[model samples]
Target chain A: MLDAVILTGLTLGAIVLGLLFIMALLSPLEALTWWAGWTSHAPSPGKLSEEVREEIEAQADRRREVGARPRFYLVYLTAIGGVSAEELSYRERVFLETLTEALPEAVIISDVYPFSVTNNPLTGERMLGWLWRKIHEKRKTITGGILATFIFARNLFNVAVSADPRYGPINNAGVAREIAKSLYRHDYPLAGDIPVVIMGWSGGGQIAVGVAPFLCLGLDAPIYVVSIGGVLTDDPGIAFVEHLWHLQGDKDHFHLISDILFPGRWPFIKNSAWNRFKRAGKMTVITPGPMSHTGKGDYFDSNAILPNGQTFVERTVEIIRDAVRTIQPPPPTSIEEELEELLGRGA
Target chain B: MLNNSLRSLMAISPELQHALLVLFLAILSLLFGNSVVLFANRVSRSQFIRSLLAFAFLFLLTFLFWTLSVQALSAMVFGVHKPFVDVFIIVSQSFTPFILGFLILLPHLGHYLYALLRVWVVINLIIHVAHAYDFGSAQALVVSLLGWLLLELATSLSFLKLDAVKRWFLKIATGKAEYRDPNDLVMAYVRAQRALMLQAAQQQEGRDA
Candidate 1:
């Protein structure tokens, strides 16, 4: 009887793992088909919150009035639990609010959904989108919570798509285009040498790195990534980033998933992009202390207090704000310089 | 000399790196007895030299047809002209992922796995073509889709009706011909197992009685 029970358990385990493996392999299809024009129309560049849009425009106006080029364009990509670019959880809203208040001079964008290459949120209109909406709604109940984990599954698969060299370049280009559109919508001067800062929390870290190379190519701007307890792989995109600041809470063991999953992250794999960046002094890892990966004690949790008498959210904002401040935007372009650039392009 | 060669390999363009990786995978797949080799071996009735030669010929033909079809379609539709050698390498190397084609033999998930492998091959083809030709993602997609469509129409209208062609395609596609209809085989196996279980239960009951 015990042997039979063991056999049944093992069979069930194998079936579940097999199904998940297939799901992972199939995950990049939507992004691939979208790029191939086989899927229904590509999602338009996602909409920004009107309030944030006005704030960004106000900053643009201020920069113009000062006759100074715009500084950093800070884009935040939320963790896997995010429902939409605009629909931030209360904790996430507070976190963004802190960043906005701390960096009034910089344009803050939180509307780009990192999980989907097309920026189509899980709750948005697509095939099986209604099912995702239902699952999200029931996320609080036990069974609903299990169903809602499919959101994580989808995002995790997207992370794989970004990391998989086979699909990464094509899919990341789509995502990079969306981000460029977002920056342009906020009045980013395409001609200016303004830096773009990507702040990725949790799984968003991997995506931010994955899309960095394409983003850099499209905009011809320096790219900086700030990962807050993010799970990152040794993606080739790391080579394109100007610098990376990774903030892991002491208690956030989940960030080590990349170390466990990616063989390239192993010590013996001496020449991975991650290691190259580290060797070049282009990556920094900071432990923010005491906070966990998510929920009550996550980086964005205002209730989580540190030994330094600051909230986790406060500490996160400070670290990111300082990182952004350290990056000096290029000096304003003189008329002669601008004319030279145009002439060069024309030639 | 090895260090210099390694440095040279590292210094090459990403497109070449990708092609080289795909070639490595193809060679590895062949070593592990890929479907094409297995099919040829089966046809040759365990004659190793004959099977190897036939496999090499089929692979060469496939490589030539795929590259030319894609190149012709791209030029006609998109007015893009890439070097024949570049397209040939990209097209042939894209087939490396079919090494995983054997996974299709799994019961219950076999057909889905087969479909996934085809999708993988298609995506790989599009990606490498785009990189090799410097085509935008959309253009690459159009080229790949049109190329496949043209090949499908040509092959179907030309050779698909032949019984030998059908048998050969089936053998190459499914890795092994013995389990051509895997689902039916699985169902039959299940039925046999159920009969044995019933027989054992009846005999136990008889002894108890």
Candidate 2:
């Protein structure tokens, strides 16, 4: 009877412990509950309280006095072919949409048509009429499988080029020049000294590198250009970065592996992210911690964040909050230390 | 005589110098620990294991404390283990989807390279979690959380500050807000679409001409 009593006690204890352990694991997950907890806390004083939410509504009230809102636009280029516009991910769309949403006083510019001479029948007519048609016809003789493979290879090549600054900047010069002209017009109130952030994902990033030099040519403002997945290079760094922000997601395997398969100045941005943000006495290279090259972040449960469906509009609202944030990078390390830091044993 | 000879021997070998240098570094690490390890670019393997141990210990301690706290208390008591566990699970799970998705996409990768990447993601996730956890005092935590939200707001503002494209986005977003007659937005969007199509066609014709 004593032995039976001990076994029952042990079984009851085990059941209690397991339930406690599992509950412990699951509670932080009730994100809505945590959010409710946050709301219960008193509102923090000052600009933070004003800047994060309902204050954006009040921001429009001052817009008339703020006058012509300074404008910035990114002319994005997706891969030459392959992934449809609809196939692009939420974050990818967010990168573009958030900025466009921002200009209470400006416009966001983009072209959906593929800049290909073949395959994009709508936009292809002029260029395909002469060169691509004959070339494609001849190539078609080599079998559809070869054609399909070529298309895939070409699409991959655009993504690769987009990641590197060297070959990409020149891929679409006319578009870059036009986009630059529109954003740089002198009429905007924030003109002359306002900040403009231009970014591109994939092919758009490549053109950004090229666009930088043109921006340098026309403007003398304290402009900040941040390119997320694009490659920009060739012209001297001084010509481009009055201040530049580059955000690369370390988790994204596509860019990480592409660096090995085809490499470039990507290491400059990638390595900086790895090391402490450089600062010189009072000045710093890029901002640090929460403010970074990567856009505003999303938790895994970002889907469950708010009202109803996890649609593009809800995410876009979140994305807007992500993009406008900034922090001055930690003061950069001494130059000698930085060089030794980046270069290592060599020199 | 043995003591005198040992003193003389200690002065003779370069190998002894190398050994002493290594010993000094190890002692330094035990003293400064990870602050020294931070000198490395990514977390070193030793540092990684150490952080894991730190996390595991903190986790165990927090759980034990919470369990102890809740045990004798009424059923209304809450356990404190949830935050750390969620942190650990998030760190582990976030990487898997991307890596697994990529693996399915690129199956032939060598095991060693894949393992290296897996380790890299784990370390980064740890950094992210720790940054979130360490805000100073309760007063400080209150301030920093607000700062985090401000940073969020500022970023959103930066996007809103863009040019022509912003208008289009506002239209789309406001259109979805649906207080309006739904047909107005659709009609506007359709007209814009038509205008863009016509413009592209015209540009193509001009080029052909």
Candidate 3:
């Protein structure tokens, strides 16, 4: 009887021990996943799996059907004193990389600094860096908020010149001359028409828009320019902005915050004018959440129209492709048109 | 499959382990899941989640005291049943040596605040073992001997052993390797909290100029 009692005690003890072991392992403290990253997509997405594959395949087919396999050159522009946009997180990096794969070649990176074989004659350090530094420092010094009224007034004066039909394009002509001087050491050099994607972040955007005369002049063919987290002064004309797309994060108050604090063309910029104009085009503006300008990952995740977790990467590709396509006005075959056609009143 | 394994791993804990699990869950849920609690202070949701998890895991394993008064209660109030006695002995024995093991491993994980508790547990175990040896206690001898041997073996394998872990060590040494959030919620939380202040400072500078 004593032996039986001892055995029962040991068995109960072991059961309790097992229970304790299980409980201890479940401790709430260890669930943190810091050294982790976002996954692209699981191997399967369940019942609608075929649909997803079909859609992806159809998109690829469309790209091929359009003569030249369309290229998506996303030149990510960065802020003043910023590092290469390549530092984008694994998730954002994957998006850009994947987008590049679908195109003819991967995105050709052009840093606001001298990131390319694009040669310059004047300073020899590459005017990209020369122009980039001046603007960034200016933004750094410019006052934020209403206190920047003096700078704002100076912006108005500059805007007047750009806005003027008489001298604006003329000044652009002078800019073209300077660019020619810089490129050829005396005269404008010939540049073949390869599509250009000019990306800028913060003050880099200012330079990207301002220096349009340099890039657009003497171009042999239509070029596509894209801006992200940037500000544009005016309609850089139908030529530069015809196929232009601007991206900004919704929660990214960086651009918005900059506008609120130093609204006009302070830091030598007057991009607020273009904001309204571009809005008219109804282009995609992604919204992640209420904006903060912390980083590109935030910018990627931020969407005005897109829900928080949706892919801005794919949507960006489609917008660029649409912009570069043949421009045709929408046909008047709306619901109203259908009724009219039924009544034989179609225009 | 991985999710199932993690869930099962997390679920199979005793009361103390359960507490650590709760801390982990709370951290992830509050920071990543709800996010309401994170922004309450300078700390972010991620940081809050991490710190609480560390607190829960570290606290339960090292700090809770076993007293003479408790032993007296076990003997008198509940009639000091054999099963209860056995459970008390196993739980207490299991915890002490593991706590010592954690202390041995803590320094390698980097200088988080929880490392202090880890060292504390090790020192306590060493002292207990020595006391056990002086009194010729068999349980103390076994636990201390096993704990010390395991500690020595782990250290040697990590350091002296080359081919097996060289790649991992190199990555870690250069900070190329990522570690699960080692209670770094404090820094992340603090950084997020400071964003508004920087904005305000910029504004103030603008006004002053």
Tell me each candidate's TM-score: 0.59, 0.31, 0.29
Candidate 2 chain A, run of 10 with poorest lDDT? A27-36
Best by TM-score: 1
lDDT scores of the candidates, listed in order: 0.70, 0.35, 0.37
Two-way TM-score contest, 2 vs 3, winner? 2
Shift in Å, residue A111, candidate 2: 3.4
Instruction: Give a tens-digit lDDT track for model 2, residues A63-161.
Output: 445554444433344433323333344555654565456544434444432222111332143422453344444444666434444344444444332
**Candidate 1 docking: what grade?**
incorrect
Candidate 3 lDDT, B70-186, residue by residue in tens: 233334543442343333333344344232222221111112323554455445544543352342344444443453454346556756664245336424333222232312332
lDDT of 3 by residue, A1-347 (tens): 99999999999779756644333322111111111111111111112223322333343334334444123233443443342343333444554555455454324443223111111211234324454334433544543222233223322233232223222332233232223223322111122233445555444454445445434433222334555555444434423443555666565555564444333424345354455435556334444334334444444432423454445555555444455443332222222323233235211
Greater DockQ among 1 and 3 belongs to 1
True-structure RMSD, every candidate: 23.8, 27.7, 28.2
State the DockQ, from 0 to 1, for candidate 3: 0.01
Tens digits of lDDT, candidate 1, A243-283: 99999887899866789777678878889888888889998
